[model samples]
Target: MFTKRAFLTLLAICIGGGTAYAQSDPLPSWNDGAVKKSITEFVAKVTTQGGPDYVPPAERIAVFDNDGTLWCEQPIYFEAAFALDRVKAMAAQHLEWKQQQPFKAFLAGDKKALAEQGEKGLLTLVAAAHSGMTTDEFAKSVADWLATAKHPRFNRPYNDLIYQPMVELLAYLRANGFKTFIVSGGGVEFMRVWAEKAYGIPPEQVVGSSGVTQFRLDAAGKPSLLKTAKVQFIDDGPGKPAGINMIIGRRPILAFGNSDGDHQMLQWTMAGSGARFAGIVHHTDAAREYAYDRPSKIGQLDKAWEEAKAKGWTVVDMKQDWKKVFAFEP
Candidate 1:
């Protein structure tokens, strides 16, 4: 027979042991499925000391695409929405915008017409909305936009739509010595303002599309960096790999993306020597999130989906693999 104190100690140990086991799951929002299994197994194999698949802490870099992989990007990209809002706000000053092709279409709420203008029209909108201001001014505008902008369907702030499983995965990877980065096709300065707070990735670790900037002195002789309309880097598709090479200087061991734009980045990551992990977040949950792939102009997943199948990369089925999508309750 055990004494009362000994019984209490045994009970405490059992409860503590159970709690430890329960809390061991790093990705609670991820269902117990192949996607979760593959991620955990890969981490375990790479992290094990003296194991064949062990990767050095210095080389443990993971790169993620921002728009559709980590966050929801349905209806239109968050950045695109921001540009439209900016166009509206500035339309008063530049009344000529109401008569222009792309701006006119966007202002008139003509989605089809805007899409017909294609990439050229989109760039025009971006340049008009993003340029002609100091970088500091641009940053402030972006911050202000993000503070008030809400997704159309969800009615929640864009940041709240970030995938919970991916967030957990990022944290888990960081805890295991992986340096995570956001390699987005969005504007560099725009993301730099909030990426750290939103994703735990510092501004220095973010590589994105950019416009040219030049140092200048204002009327008051205050030094400032002015954003220009000239195109600098696109940071999409082939440019994704180029941006990684130029900015990060190291090939990532792991890459996560959701569309064709991220194809080359995934290819570049897997082409490196050693064990690599490449994942594509397939948006299959129509009920929880919008599902679009081949025909969708925004975040199209067609080419990358086929490539992922051929290359044996992990394809995360959002509907089947995740117990929850957003971090917040609906």
Candidate 2:
């Protein structure tokens, strides 16, 4: 009973609406540029059925570096700050710390002395602070710290400082059938405490450095895992690839990171067969975020930066490529 002209108009409207919906932007936080185009195009090619570059859903593995890549790690790594705080909290019980070199310098706010202590000193602090507790207790402690600790410059909870564009990218990849995992140099226990809530990546999907732990049975017949001071693994640089191979058991098709620590991971991903994507989130926005490469002590991006450029990997200029850095930005 419908008029032919009216039927044609309804059909046109439906078609147009569907087209608009299909064209909606998945990475709204990213600016319209070559970088964005490359990302979208890569995704399209890899997802196209029967295409040469098409990757099966089960094989679409993506890995990301957590600190500085997904969130900020400046002034000092957040875990370092937590370790320092833990040292202060435990100082009263350990009188020997008053005479210890790094502890004494740290407690007295001697920056020069603390710097002299270097990596060894830092490890000592971490061991002192992170060990001697049950895994559940350690997790609760990390969660409690995250609930209260704020970044000095941003004055916001550390978890709240995650990159908006990267978060969107994660979701877009997941929507396209990519399984995301976080591969970081930070402590496995520390990252697992808040990563799921912050990045939509669950704890089991996180691969990171770890300290030794022992299973214990309490007098009440309660079985628990106790964290020990012994270092087990360091998931950085070459260790990144080793961790991926050991844990994931599958080479990632896509890998993203911010510094030299991720160099091996990027290299490993690119070495895989078929379509591969490697990206570096360059911290060029000093105003909205911290910026440093090579010279900086924390999150140095020297060798990896050069490699990314030479290999034609997407190196995102955070200041230019992202319209919004953080969700809190106006």
Assess every candidate by TM-score. 0.90, 0.92
lDDT of 2 by residue, 1-330 (tens): 899998887787676544434338888899999999989999999999999999999999999998899998998889988888888888999999989988999888999999999989888988999999999999988888888989999999988899999998998899899999999999989999988888899999999999999999999999999999999999999999999999999999999999999999999999999999999999889999977888988999999999888989999999999999999999
Pairs that clash in candidate 2? none
User: Which parts of model 1 have CA positions greater than 4 angstroms off?
Assistant: 1-23, 108-116
lDDT of each: 0.90, 0.92
For candidate 1, the lDDT comes to 0.90
Please report, as a residue range, the 10-residue window in candidate 2 with the lowest summed lDDT. 14-23
Local lDDT at 82 for model 2 = 88
Q: Write the per-residue lDDT of candidate 1 for residues 1-330, one digit (tens) a residue.
A: 799998888688676534445357878889998889989998988899999999999889999999999888888888989987898888899889888999899889999999999999987987899999999999999988888988899988888888988988998898789999999998889889988888899999999999999999989999999999998999999999999999999999999999999999999999998789999999898999988788888899988889899989999999999999987754
Q: How does residue 73 of candidate 2 score in lDDT?
A: 90
For this target, which candidate reaches the highest TM-score against the unseen true structure? 2
